[model samples]
Target: MSFSLRPQPARWFELLTAREDLTLAVETLARTGAVELETHSETATPLVLPDLRGRLEEYNRLAQHYQHYWPQDELRPSNLPGRPVDTFNHALQRLYAWRDAADAVVRRSEALRGELYELEMLREMLLAQGDTPLDLGLLAGAGPALAARLFVLPPRTHIAQIPAAILHTSVHGKVHDFLLAVGPPAEVDLLEQELTLHKGRPMHLPPWLQRGTDASLAALDQRTAAIQAEQRVLEQQLTALQEEHRLVEALGDIARLEWFLTHVEALPVSETFAWVTGWTSDLDGKVLQQALDRAQVRSLLRFPDPPRDKVPPMVFHNPWWAQPFELFARLLGTPARDEADPSRLLVFIVPLMFGYMFGDLGQGFVLLLAGLLLGRRVPTLRLLVPGGLASMLFGLLFGSVFSREDIIPPLWLHPLDQPLLVLAIPLLGGVLLLLLGLLLNGIEAYWRGALRDWLAMDAALLLIYLGGLGLLLTPYAALAALTGLFWYLGARLQRAGGDLRVLGGALGRLLEYTMQLIVNTLSFTRVGAFCLAHAGLSVAVVGLAEAGGHPLLSAIILLLGNGVIIILEGLVVSIQVTRLVLFEFFIRFLRGEGRRFQPLPAPPHKTERT
Candidate 1:
């Protein structure tokens, strides 16, 4: 259950602005830290003007330094030190500028190297072509013949005579060239038979052009190497300068801290120093209290009385359970009072549902261990420890270890092997939880002095719940008696003597109440569904492992299966559990909008004395 906040107005005045006598009175009252003070002045005196001006000048100088080193903001936090806001801004600027300069240098170097390589390649190709004035047209004609024979050509020209006695030309280009024998062979009669014979001629051409290409390539490589070395030197120098700048900026923070302390020490005794001042029409005493508490001071002042409208305070005791419900409230966009404790509900349902959803001992242990390690590193995962523990507990109950039920004898029933028990537990848990909500609702309504609501909404709900239980356990007669009593109390609470309007409202509420009962009960069905899903997923993992022929493959399958269950099923179960708590449980009992308690400001001198 949550408490309501009563906000009141409080205004505080410091002695520095008052007349001598009023100043003395304020100082005397401040000694007790109980009385609120008020003083009005025509004008306010400036405080810390010199210090502010000095800090601003320091900030500007630092900003200029940052702009020089880093023109673009790509520096990581590890590169910077100190939390001085002004100095940090300047450092970031410098880091970005330095990065931009480095990038530009690298880009220019790469572009130059690329162009040099392309020029070198062109020079080599030219050299390979040689000085010969060979007929390129003849070379083109002989290209196909050279390609077919897989022969190389020298940079020269030659001629050949065919068997038909016709002349043909052949030209050798830089890479390759060949001749074409287009005429038919001659026939000679010898040894009583006719035979056709022709002889083909071959010629060799030496490659003189490749020598010049090698020299040009070598020169370009040397030039590129020198340029790269120069670029490296520039990069090293920039890095060193940036490091020095970072150190100086860090030292600046220490200087600023010293300056702040010096100014704080210089303030007059018995003088009121204002840290902050603001005006608001709806400023509440609670808001002032919160500010003072955060400031860790005992004296605070505010104007006008706080608003008296009855609105609950906002408190986040259990963020894990409360956050999801808060989202729902925002969507509804209307005020609701939940009288039950969400933290307790979360405590009960989250782990229970998770256990049912993930009921394999080996996998549950893995989840528990992972959750524990993560909780150590991250504060947010701390809440999940209970849920993990619950999963392990349920896994033990189901007698499942890594989806195999043969590891241990069945304690209750295996989810896959015995589906009935799986369904029964969730349904039973839901009915009981709903009844618990109705009980809380009745208590809350009675406390809030809404007897009519208590008897009509809560009492009728109780009878309906009990009557259902009775019918389930015993006979229809027991249910009828309870039902008659529920209708009588509801009708009386509605004041439905003869008016149709009163009777209609009662009937409508009764119907809405019944609908809530049905929905709340059905919501728990997810518990059984998740249990089956957990069992089925584990079975699939085992199946995949069996399908893999290799021993190593099976191990990999098991690893993957555990990983998937922990990440995927773990998230789904968490969400489902959260939904059950927020919708089913909270809808019945919790009221959360309560303002938090805040205190006042205290003088530094007084703090030291305490």
Candidate 2:
């Protein structure tokens, strides 16, 4: 499935001059080589060129303009040695400056109006208390009402008397009495004196006096309004400057990127490079040929030999659904050079198990809808749309609608209500999947020319699975057959290896195989457990909703219950499904550590005037 490419001598070429057309020719040849080549340039390091000075300037301007919209620290640039560093720094400075100025203007405008509003409110509060005269003689009376109103009162204190000149009111056990004995003119003077006495403390006064003090607050509001208008004009000017900054910054980036690509093409290098190399499978070969043919490449050098060691596979850019299939292909192990179709066994099984455990029609529909709607915005969720749809399909079979079985008639049986069926299906599925994994392992081992190891290792698993299935059907006969086969395989493998170490290794593998059977069979039980948990949780939600008396409260309960089930159960099921794939299935067949192949392509350039 894997190949290592060795570069042929004839394919190598060296460029004498650094002219643009010559650079383009060299790139065309490299692309046609149908292989990734390593090279060291004698000219200036192609990656390093002019700094993004223009981009940094524009970024700074934009940052300043939007400074108020974001946190101060967000606008700051990192000190890394790249275009990003300079660009972000410039943006941060500009944003912070503009943000600070705009914020200050807004603050000033608001502060003036806020002060005026508070002053006006205070005047209105005082006016509501009304005019009252101060009585100096009443302070000496020591009557219950006088004592309660003038100062502190003990618990259960009551106002016993009020003079004709005093108005008394009690609020929440606190008494207030305004003396009406003195005329308005004399009382105003006395009130001014009392206010001075309690400079920092709250003082009781007649409401009429408070109403007459709002002229200053009205004047303050007018000043604040003027300041706010001026601030808006400054903001408008800042916005215009920011747009110009962004356009300049974008231009600088494009220019810098073009410069890098142009420099890569102009390297004074030979077609043949002294470095490690490798070849890829037929699919990779075809893709490479197509890319080259599209570019109209000709007269190129290449090595037709398969790679000697493992090489990175070439990745083709495609839509999201296609990515999973591609990733699965890579995981299953490399295909033979001549093989056109890669194995897709894992793709079907992984999703099926995921849907089975997560089955709930209503929740599944929500997931499908949300996934479809959000997939364009977030590419990663595209997989979930198909996954959710699959779950809903299975859910329908199980008659599980929002975790309640009553909504639909079961085509088979409810997983929770029929515990035996639940346990049986996952175990059977596991047995079959494990066998498939072993079969794949054997096939890959055979292809790699490790027949003995394939028989001793992968074939041993097949025997265990078949023997286990047979035992489940007819215990005594299957047990007898499995015991004989296990011993026979063990002895044969031992004799095949003459070395003492090899025998010991073979024995160790036998023990490991026995342990794996016990563990893998038990792991499938999780599928049943999750199915029951989903049903139980949904029932609990329905019970709680029904218990509530009010319609609104019941509805709220139901909403919360469904939300919890969707988020919590959804995550747990997803993790469990992935675990089954990665550990149970992948461990048996997948060799996923190979690096991907990437070929050199044409460098981008802008035409220059003569």
What's each prediction's TM-score? 0.53, 0.56
**In every candidate, how many clashes are there?**
43, 29
- The TM-score of candidate 1 is 0.53
lDDT of 1 by residue, 163-225 (tens): 334233343444434342222122111200211122222321212222343543455466657
The candidate maximizing lDDT is: 2
Residue runs of model 2 more than 4 Å from their true location after superposition: 1-250, 253-255, 258-310, 314-322, 325-343, 476-508, 597-610
Error of 1 at 541 (Å): 3.2
True-vs-predicted CA distance for residue 146, candidate 1, Å: 38
Q: What is the lDDT of residue 332 in candidate 2?
A: 50
| Model 2: per-residue Cα lDDT over 1-610, one tens digit each | 2222111121222223222233223343344545454333333223322454454456556545443543332121111223333434554455555555556554664565555554344344334344434332233243443331222223343444434444444222223222222223343344434533443122332122211224323443565466567757755655555453442343333433433343343233333321222332323345444543454433232444433333335433333345554544454544432222222453467567777788778888988888889878986566577678878988898888876677789787777678878877887898778776666666666656787866765565566657756876687657755764665466555667644555666656666776796688779889888877787788889889889998999889988888898889878887887677667866775654344555555333221212
Residue 373 CA error for candidate 1 (Å)? 3.3
Task: Give RMSD to native, each candidate.
Answer: 16.9, 12.9
42, model 1: CA deviation in Å? 16
